[model samples]
Target: GKTQNIYALNYNDKDNDIKISLGLLDTKHNWSGWISPVNGKGTKSDTPNKRWNFNIQKSVDLTNKDEMVFGLQYTKDSMHKTEHNLVNGELNKQSKGNTRSYGLYIQNDHKFDNKWSILSGIRYDNWKVYDSWMQLDKDKSKTIYYPARSDSSFSPKIALQYKIDDESNLFTSWGKAFAAPTLQKMFSGSASSASYTEANPNLNPQTVKTVEIGYKKKFGESTILGVTYYHNDINDLLYTRKTGLGKITYTVNGSTYTKDKQRVENAGTATTNGIELDLNHKINDQWSMFANYMYQQSKIDKCSTNGAAEGKIMTYVPKHVFNLGVDYSAGKWNSELVGSYQSKMYAQDNNSDTAKGVYTAYDPYFVVDFNLTYSMDKNSSISFAVNNLFDKEYYSYNLCEGRNYMLTVDYNF
Candidate 1:
């Protein structure tokens, strides 16, 4: 079943990116997202998820062989969802929230003679959730207002490299990473209409400490191979409880009310040990092949729920992933083919979806894609692509898309 509007043309917004590098200064600005038109009557959309980022970097000389880099960055992210009643043309506001982030970082690269080199960097980030509001309506009516919230963190990384002969090299590094809740999670208020779900504003960020070692080698100018083994220790990992309960308060029409709200919490700790391999080879002047594979094992080191989830594997994280691809080029024609595979995956923490005789899991699946392009000149090209070329049946929770084809024409000014 389908419908069509033959007389109208749909216009979609595009991303805006600008970058500059001059002398010792470098800067980048990017803005993109979908915003529901507040006044466009015929268009429909999900919650608007608008984002903006601006960063600037400067290079300074600490010695001639040693260099230091300084950077400053700012970011803004917001989500606003609204819907209009079809019959009466009345507008209703569902959710509104925004967040801002400021960051500063410094790094130094030092070359100690011809055989040894090192890079070290430290970053500080501050995030704030502000100017957020939520209401089913707008007349001093049913609404919940979230309080302003903030979080800050410091992360540091260091790496060293050594020259082995002239064709191969070895490297090792240690780094700290952190993830904080998004504006949607930190500022969403409880919906009075829902009986048992509410939002929390005081959740802690997840953090990981990583250590890695690796070796890489180049065989001539057309071939390269690299491999790495790494481990991560993650704490205060964030997972949604879904049925989490907390108290909420709001006022309407000279009356105040309070109720329990359900949301997510900081609930677990985990560790991952993994190995990755990458290889690329150019068979000749017109043909090349590339492949990569990852073997990862992650376990729940601790669970706050203290039940079936205590020792289970993390959800949706596969133990194996492999990708293989090749490319070809002729006078005016270019072609590529790629194949990818994933091992089995579980969809939930409980791992209990197996109400049947067997535990239901997402089956391992493989997919392949092909593309061909013809160049008309230096400024234009036409491409035809076959995605999911075999139309494999699979599921990552829900059924995946089937085989499809596309043709595109691109031009540059």
Candidate 2:
């Protein structure tokens, strides 16, 4: 176990949001504006971020019952990450890097009567990376420096919706999304000391193109059900690859000065397709139920990862997930129960010799949660909730925190 006081965590965040809507005029003209500013800081262990953003829009009536909306938005952000570690009984990790970005966006939404609608938007983003103060090897005490780099691109999206009736609707969307490498990725040079793994500095931004179609139907008086099918093609999927695990090598300006650098490549490609279903049903005046199900698959198209061949499933992506829950209320009492399940998934490809057998695959698991509430009055209540009711072993986003329980009490007047 690590020592106490060996690490201290500090954090600070401040944010402000403002909005204005002018709705007094006629239907021919209306305007709205929104603005936000955010700032954050942390100790030597986390990243520091700050940003400012604003959006304004105006709607104009074009003829009998149809309207055209025009909108513009701007955002700017700056981020910094400090790298620190202890080495040779001394604090020698004083690396720092930063990134800055600016974006411009425009969007429009139009409605025809009340049966059909369309939405479209486009955005341009530009960003730069600054890297410095990186060490390659402590044994030889070598360091490497990279020049600042910058890139920019455009992303767009379009969606359409049609009302099938008063209780049903159909919609579809095709969109493109982009992400830029963070300052940590750009400055954490590909050098591993005696303790840490090599960090890739040449990492590139990942991108994905997605298409989805869905339909929603409302049945009975208080029940709703919907289903969606989605497919995505991704490029430049970034991942850390462990090269030959031999003695490390370190260099400076093309010369082999130290022997502590591990070779690595930070790029790959992936494709994912999935189907999702959601339902909400009211059993009576005092009881309701909800269910959600998802089936998805991820495949690595290109990579040299362990057991990752041309069309194998990616690591850590479960194929099936289901969640069911119920809520009840009667007079002054209310309660809820929810259960979730996940299907088994492979930790590595089947062909690999070291691969765990099918039976040893990650096991399917279930968890149940419960909540109860008592109304002290019309304007007050006390509630208690317990998560992981059975304390079943499970993982969320690759992390396990064990069973958790909490209690909350509130009063209003």
Q: Candidate 1, which segments miss by more than 4 Å at Cα?
A: 1-45, 58-64, 83-93, 136-142, 186-201, 220-222, 242-263, 305-307, 354-363, 374-382, 408-413
Candidate 1 is scored at a TM of 0.75
Q: Report lDDT (Cα) of residue 294, candidate 2.
A: 98
The residue-by-residue lDDT of candidate 2 on 71-138, one tens digit each, is 44444444333333312233333345555666666566777759988878887777766654455333
- Whole-model lDDT, candidate 1? 0.72
Estimate every model's Cα lDDT from 0 to 1: 0.72, 0.63
Off by over 4 Å in 2: 1-89, 92-94, 137-141, 182-196, 242-266, 304-308, 329-335, 345-363, 371-384, 395-399, 407-413
Model 1 Cα lDDT, one tens digit per residue, 1-413 = 11212221222222322232222111121212222245323312135466666666667778977888887877777766654443344565466777888888989999997889999999898888877776656453777777787888899999999988677999999999877777557544433222334455567778889999999999998899999999999888776553234566743222345754545667778888999999999999999999999999988778785456667777668899999999999999999999999988765566544332232347788999999999999989999999999998776545677899999998765
